[model samples]
Target: MHDAPGLVAILAYDGLCTFEFGIAIEIFALPRPEFDFAWYRHSIVAVDRGPLRATGGFMVSADAGYEALTEARTIVIPGWRSRDELPPHALLDALRQAHERGARLLSICSGVFVLAAAGLLDGKRATTHWRYCDELARRFPAILVDPAVLYVDSGQVITSAGSAAGIDACLHLVERDFGAHVSNTVARRLVMAPLRAGGQAQFIAAPVAQVPRHDLAAVLEWARERLGETLTVPQMAAKALMSERTFLRRFKDATGMTPKAWLQHERMARARSLLETSALDTEQVAQRCGFASAESFRVAFRKAVGLAPSFYRERFGARQR
Candidate 1:
């Protein structure tokens, strides 16, 4: 067998996330004899000694300690047990040293807490599971928190949203290192989409958890009805009888997104449904979604949906009407 280029060390701790841990192992550790290219070698190292409890009701013991992290080219931190509990000093130091020596750090879901504790995410754009996005932002004010994306790759440090997004991040790393074809092969073996066509926003039912106050809810309802028309911040404010400044502030509070971002989100939702249900072509879909131009619609749709309109329609359309 051809030797792989680098070793991937996964940091396993007590109360580990079985799903995220499994994703990391499946992507990097699984044997792929079908491909001639050497894959990453895998090592599961304990952040501390003894047995680690996985979230999926199992116990696992690691053969190595945190020191293994120092020698790894890539280190994976699966979901952390709690954001409240600080990572061990040795673990944090090893992460810092590894990062300084040019090792790539990846965190799945709440495992970002460890990176945050190590100061690796300071001033870097990061993402975590949507459930913890607010808390991550609140705790680490310096880190730019983007809760909407499936993952954020800030060069050396990469983070993924909850659960399956970890697979996306791992596959992304594979694509970045070995190229698209290799990643796609691995994805096929795993029976997953070669490239998922969406972000965390599609999965989030309530983008904003807090119940909007009466006025804000009314404003949201009004905007919801007008997604096919050009919506301005001032117009949303006027509907709620508020000034522009207040509207912007309250919009963020009510939706966990700025008015512009929320409007794009809403429009995409409408466009996505139309693409799924209507026989209208791309240009018609864009027009009905209130996009200024088909080009702009394509850009926004690709960004929000993680795939082109044609692809989404092909994948999701229900005998287009």
Candidate 2:
């Protein structure tokens, strides 16, 4: 018999950050009938004894207590009640034990403080809401706090910035576990983009003016449909019927990334899909994804995916028994 995916324990405490907690539940607890494989098993763990009162004047009843964390393979800490207040000693002990046993820990927003208080974030790079980055670095001198990024994935421990960024981190974990296809499926259900690179800026400064590009939609679709070709910024600009200079400016304004970066993202996404679903060999896959050659594909794929192409296929590709 095949083994089930790991259990996810989402913590619930008094004064819970409702939106952050909801994001965890929505991503990990929802039934995913689309996939044939076993979905995650989840339990709501109570950090505070008795009934927990969440923000927005609602109560939360947990499925289990701190002891339940021992059985979980992944623990999700939503935003803590207060960043200044350290978590309970019992709770901190449980987290330390879980980490020692090789369980993964994830934190959203101020929840990073909980992990920090447990001493789990020492010597690792982490991120939190941009507003708290200074304090996190101040309180935990051992941690390297990056204020700009959406999230930081340090193997066993992952941390994300404020509210909505939690969704990006959760989706990233899903992708890490089940591959790009599964992650994209979850994102589709959530009505969000399949993947946003972790290095993406958490906050974008206001633009001088919003560019109107109702026509750029067609150009983007065109680019996707022709990823196999040697497409250039000039070509894309021509397709959008704008000068290259104007296209570059408007494109960055419309999407968070530059035109070249967006194209690379699209190409990598297509490569992942082909790797999982197609029978193409590495060279063919590279050609289809518009890579210059197999060696270039290998380097880029490894850099982007943290795995060699062959290894990724071996791990996630469709198998024939």
Candidate 3:
């Protein structure tokens, strides 16, 4: 947690979005003593070691410039002024050095441009705001830009979609580093959901189906209620009263994932909830989630979430009072 020699450095550039910059500061820089653990040691580092003006007529001074990148364990690049402009050579070098030294790098919204310019995202699967996805992909053909996701965590480098998705990315970082409980605590303080289902497309507008299709919704609800049961696509399709092909098509159209993928995600989510909120062991949790065995649950959970179930619960679960 906070006891670790971890410094969270935010890259502050001239003409940066004050709101996006503020999101990083609010999440990482704020002091919280109730948790009885030290949170991140935070600092604002300018791209150039000088006073910088934010987008909305406010100026902020920083402690250090690119030099601060070397000392940081986690580097956060919020939003840049423009995507067309490249980051300065000095800043790019510093970012490269930090990454080479094993610092976790993050870019929120348009900040992906900085990482892209630095070549950190050259061959990586990354994302930015949905609006800039086309531009980002077009500019850097080497990078795999997935616009449908809210955020993509490719180990040391993480990039989030626009605006509030940055909050999700930051909380995800906290969850990854300190565990789920700490993340949930911080998320509660911020008055936002600890987790969001599906992808960025869920937030976008699309043509609604002309037919009223309550069947898909009903089947999903049924599956959720019967998570402990041996649920399969055939069972789900049967409940929806459609052929498997038709059901799968409509399911993907509505939710952007197949029924199997959605079920697995739901199962993992339920496993996390039970892990955090109850005293259930991994075995019970696995059974509840229809994973058949604790070993299976562990493998699936780690594959989906990048952490083991026990570790996730330890970090996120509330202590028994």
Candidate 4:
């Protein structure tokens, strides 16, 4: 482990998303006896410990109160029920104290609203779910909200776009604290993809396709099976039976990426899987993933993931006997 495991406290408020809370619990609280490394000590601290109703009518109880914030090395706000409603004054004060003591703060989805209400996000680059980006900006004009990326890490504060993005942000935290290898191991055990290529734009909804338009979904599936092949846009267009122009437009509307960009992402994703699950040399892995050489794969992988291929493998690859 790079650093000793820290105390992690998740704020449980009324009307929390149980899924988001579970994401934090699963990543930080779950046992990982395989690594023989220290793990975070977690707690569910309520603003008030009464019976609280989570999202979808699930009931939960917290073991501690807002005071728990004072001792936590990292504080996570899963989500807030209403953006317009202000967080409790006592809770805000505790958060402020936590910040003063240098605790790392994070928010998932609409939880950004709570941090904004506490005046913690003013003049800082932050993000929330795309659906709430405009309002989050309108309500807090001082904050810089980028709706494109999956998450933003601004030193002490971090925020994620939506539900599953919370996993991305949390995994990133593990990477920051321990190393990529530990984070990758945790991701594998949880059965989650090690990383998602591209930005939230890929997942954002777009205008409906014209009725006469050829479906690009089938072409995308076909391309996945041929990632190791030298596939091109014209080839994909042919599979969809459309001219390049119509194929490109429809592909973007459907998947929020150009055909070429999507193919690169697919290839890089396959590369990561090989690095994590196989012992093949980088050159062999590059060939299996359709890259011309290890050098070319390294450039593309770094551009896509912000890390070198060998570094990624070192973190996520199966341990040697």
Candidate 5:
């Protein structure tokens, strides 16, 4: 088991998103008797004065204030009250100091706005909910806003897309701190998938929430099954029985990514799975993922995952642990 990760401070304020706030509590604060080792120690820190109002017509009282952030190893910012509402100056200052002292800051949903307002996300790649991505970009031009991703893990600052994507980012942190085994166990308790790659698309064109386009679902499924093969836009378009131009537009509308980008994400996702679960060598994994060569795979994997395949395997592989 890994050493205990230090205190986690979850901020509470007026107009709180109860769901997002609850996510932090569930992942970090909940007692985990399943593990013999110590889990995260958490505290709710108040961003405003007494009797803060939250969503669903309830009030919350925090255990501490901004000062609690100082000793925290990690801080979670739940969905902000509004995109336009700037965070309190004191709260912003506290966050900046916490970050300067090397505390990891995790922002969920609209909470990215708070980080952006605090200038913590300057010159860094970040993502927020798709609806706010454009506004986030417009408001903070220095921040590289990725609308396609479920989350952006920029080392100290991790930002997640809307709502449930916060669960993915939190589980990812647990994996980083402990290991895949521990994270997967936690996921089982939560009844959720063990992990979702942060690079996975967020489906910006949410016609019916998460429902896929009927015309493209079959083609997408076929393409996913054939990730090891050389698939092209035209091939996908042909499979979908649409003209190239129409296919391209429809694909983006359905998936919020170009065919090539989607393919890369799928390949990388498969590569990550193989690295975590398989005994295959790097070259074999690369071949399975349709990379021309192991070297090409190494370059691409490092670029996309921020880690080499071997190192990733060593750190996350079930057998290695």
Candidate 6:
């Protein structure tokens, strides 16, 4: 089997998208003199062996072709143009071959359809752009299409939601290949949030909650300001001038998660922020995040981030310190 941290090939095609394409290059192909070890040797590969005409009346060409996908350690298919159009059989074979040889595969947005077309997503839980979730589910019934999450990593293959969510997936890959410290470095260079708090569902349209409700909005802001406090559903309901049952139903409708789940997500995000930006001890961080104890924080952080709080802090803490 091929070893980790090697060449990365991004598959391109006749129709190119600027955002996802730029994100791929920004994440994988950029020069990283900050790190002591060599970063990815990246190349853009033409799937059809021709110049590309992008959506915005632009022409582009690849540095290499499908042959690169065969040898690369990671193969990324940034947003494909259409889900209806299938990729070439040759490209499909190349992807399958790469996966067989232990190259990690990743897709952004509609690129999931290309992976799905190749049968790579047959039995995997994958995600696509929120707009195409239903179509992906209808077309590939076997693949569990999680429409709520920003991305899904099924070990060998990873899929992400539309457009900007691709950046999150790419950073996640960087974290996997290197570590949180490297990912944070890259994110800092990009001037973007290194991590996000909510899921794709939060961005999806909720007609009822789309407009501002003074009572609910006020309570939400209040709760956000006090993430360290033990904010219960009844307390929130009282703050919003609603019954507990009403608040529970409305909260889910508004935020697409129950109060408890939302609180946990906020706490997780706060913990991450603390881990990255502050030098607090694990117990202090846990207390600040409203976790019952440092042990509970460790358990929850491990479950959410796949790393212990202290270890995460060690890896992702701000370099300025």
lDDT of 6 by residue, 1-321 (tens): 112478889887888877788889998988888876677899989887657887788887788878888789999998887788988999999999999999999999999998998899998899988999999999999999999988999998989998899999999998776655667789999998777655688788756656455456788779888988889888999998888887887787667688888788878878887887877899999999898899999999999888888777766666622
Query: For model 1, how big is the CA root-mean-square deviation?
Result: 9.4
Choose the strongest candidate by TM-score. 2
lDDT at residue 47 of model 3 (Cα atoms) = 78
Better of 2 and 3 by TM-score: 2
lDDT of 2 by residue, 1-321 (tens): 124668999999989999999999999999988888888999999998877999999999998998889999999999998988978999999999999999999999999999999999999999999889999999999999988788899999999998888999999899888888788889999999887633435265565555555467899989999998999999999999999999987787666578888888888999999998899999999999899999999999999899999998877777710
lDDT of 1: 0.82
Model 4 lDDT tens row, 1-321: 234668899988788888889999999888778766678998889975567898899888888887778889999999888888888999899998899889999899988999999999999999989999999999999999999877899889999999888999999898767655567778899898666655677678766655767766687789888887899888988888988888887787666667778788788777877887788988988888888988998998888777798887765565621
Pick by lDDT: which candidate is best?
Answer: 2
Off by over 4 Å in 5: 1-4, 31-38, 82-86, 130-149, 178-213
Candidate 5: residue 298 Cα off by (Å)? 0.9
Clash number for candidate 3: 4
- lDDT scores in order: 0.82, 0.89, 0.85, 0.83, 0.87, 0.84
Q: What does each candidate score in C-alpha RMSD?
A: 9.4, 2.6, 3.3, 3.9, 3.7, 3.9
Could you tell me how far off, in angstroms, the CA of residue 306 lies in candidate 6 after the best superposition? 2.2
Model 5, 101-173: lDDT tens digits are 9999999999999999999999999998888889999989999999878888999999999989899999989
Position 23, candidate 1: lDDT: 93
- Show the colliding residue pairs in model 5: none
For candidate 1, write residues 286-305 as lDDT tens digits.
98888989999999989866
Clash pairs (backbone) in predicted model 1? none
**Error in Å for residue 300 of model 3:** 1.1
